[model samples]
Target: MVTILFFGQLKERLDTSRLPLELVDGSKCLDSVAELRIFLQTKGDVWKENLAYGSALVAVNQQMATEDTPIKDSDEIAFFPPVTGG
Candidate 1:
């Protein structure tokens, strides 16, 4: 199983603050950030738009991650809008 979290405006847009995912059966194969995004997009159009490549910032287990970053069961993934500096 894995945990996904949303933050900031992304939380509002998605109408969710967290999700617990099970990587079993057909989903057990997910192993990278890009793969995860693709899977999540299947949830709906909102997921597709908000989580599109490079659209949101990501962190895996509290550390910054890239598309190729490897993931596994029990990992925690977070998504949020890009931060802007004033």
Candidate 2:
């Protein structure tokens, strides 16, 4: 299982702060951030919009991650809306 976290407006927007996910058997060997987003998108239209590519920032095991980032069981993945400073 993987631990997925949502932060900032993303959490409010998705109405969830965290989730535990089990990878499907066949896809376990090569699961990635992109695939995770796609899976989450199935949750609802809110998730589909909020987790869309380039809509939020992602991290794996607390380090910045890209779509190709590999995901493993027990790993922590976080999603946060992009921040800007004035």
Q: Give the top-scoring candidate (lDDT).
A: 1
Please report, as a residue range, the 10-residue window in candidate 2 with the lowest summed lDDT.
Answer: 21-30
Candidate 2, 1-86: lDDT as tens digits: 88999999998998889998887756454399999898899889999999999899999999999999999889999999988999
Count of steric clashes across candidates, in order: 0, 0
Tens-digit per-residue lDDT, 1-86, candidate 1: 89999999889989999999876657358889998899999999999999998789899999999999998899999999998899
Against the reference, the lDDT scores of all candidates come to 0.91, 0.90
Which residue pairs collide in model 2, if any? none
The residue ranges of model 2 lying beyond 4 angstroms of the native Cα positions read 25-30
